[model samples]
Target: MYAVFKRELFSLLNSLMAYITIGIFLLAAGLLLWFFPDTSILDYGYAELTGFFSLAPFLFMFLIPAICMRSFAEERREGTYILLATRPLTSWQIIGAKYFACLVLVVFSLVPTLIYGYTISKLAMPAGNVDTGAIIGSYIGLLLLGAAFTAIGIFASSITKNQVIAFAVAVFLCFIMYNGFDAMAKMALLTGLQDLFMFLSVNEHYQSISRGVLDTRDAVYFLTLVFFFLLLTHFTIGGRKW
Candidate 1:
């Protein structure tokens, strides 16, 4: 797992993909937080990091899929996946390693935003009245959400050898997972099942955590989502040779 993890991390950095993705994230963060006239964080006249976190995750919805699209799809296209498949690593380990590599990249790209938070803290009128706890909580939620997206993306990539189709499927699935349940909640037919739909939706739980309310239910939902898709990825790979 460690070897596969290292190889993935190294390969991502060795290509322009990592740099390009990071650049896109930073640019989106900047544009939304600074350049936008009305909703810009700089114009909000507050020291809170709310603007950054709110915008980051939505941007991540698209960005993360692009990052993971090539994970297995590239290997399949290049016919290098067989090499890794024959290794001693189990299917779960391979998928987990890829998931970890993608998670690391997501976390690494987010490191720069700490400075944005720090800047806000220093600029606060009282010199540090920022809700540090809420900010930290939001960051944790973001990490979990990113992890969930990466797992979904890896599963999508594994299902097909074409990166383009993998990317499309990943983006569509991520969008649905992120907000599909909430949308379903509004359906007249499912009116009585609102709670069930919300419970199944990622955005509902994610929003709860983003507000600094650490609910066990929300954590369990994300963990379950990650686990289910991961198991599916394992099955997809396992059934390939069967």
Candidate 2:
């Protein structure tokens, strides 16, 4: 698993497209947080990263799929997945290695954004008036969200040999996971089931965690989402063999 992880990570690092994608994510984030008049934190007259936190998941909807689209799609396209499957590693191990590798790239994309928090802190009244707890909670939530998205992306990749198709499917799934339930919950006809829909929505749990409360339910929801998607990926690859 470690060997596969290392190789996958290095492969991503060696790809120019990976760098471009990460760079685009960071650049877009910076522009939204600092430059865009409507979304800019500076214009909001607050030290909080509410705007950033709100905008990030939307950006991630595209960025993560792009990162993971090549995971299995590229392998299968080049006929290298068969070679990979013949290795000693179990399906879970292979999936895990690829998932973690993609996740590490997500982490790398996020780590640079810490400077946003620090800058906000320094810009705050008295040199540090920002809500530290909220910022921490939001970061944690973002990480979990990214993890779940990575799992979904990996699962999408495992099902298709075309990277573009994997990307589109992953994006569609992520959007639905993040917003579809909440939308359905809002329908006048679904009032009776609103609670259930909200409970299943990724945005619901993400918002709960972003409030700096760190509820176990929200954490479990995210972990379960990640696990469920990964399990799907495992079944996907296994089915290809049979």
Best by TM-score: 2
CA-lDDT, candidates in order: 0.86, 0.95
lDDT by residue for model 1 (35-139), tens: 898768778899897888777767887788888999989998899988998899888899999999988898888898888878888989899988888888898
Q: Candidate 1: worst 10 consecutive residues by lDDT?
A: 187-196
Against the true structure, candidate 2 reaches a TM-score of 0.98
Single out the weakest 10-residue window by summed lDDT for candidate 2.
187-196
Model 2 per-residue lDDT tens digits across residues 1-242: 99999999999999999999999999999999999999998899988899999999999999999999999999988998888888898999999999999999999999999999999999999899989999999999999999999999999999999999999999999999999999999983766699889999999999999999999989999999999999999889998862
* Count of backbone collisions in candidate 2: 0
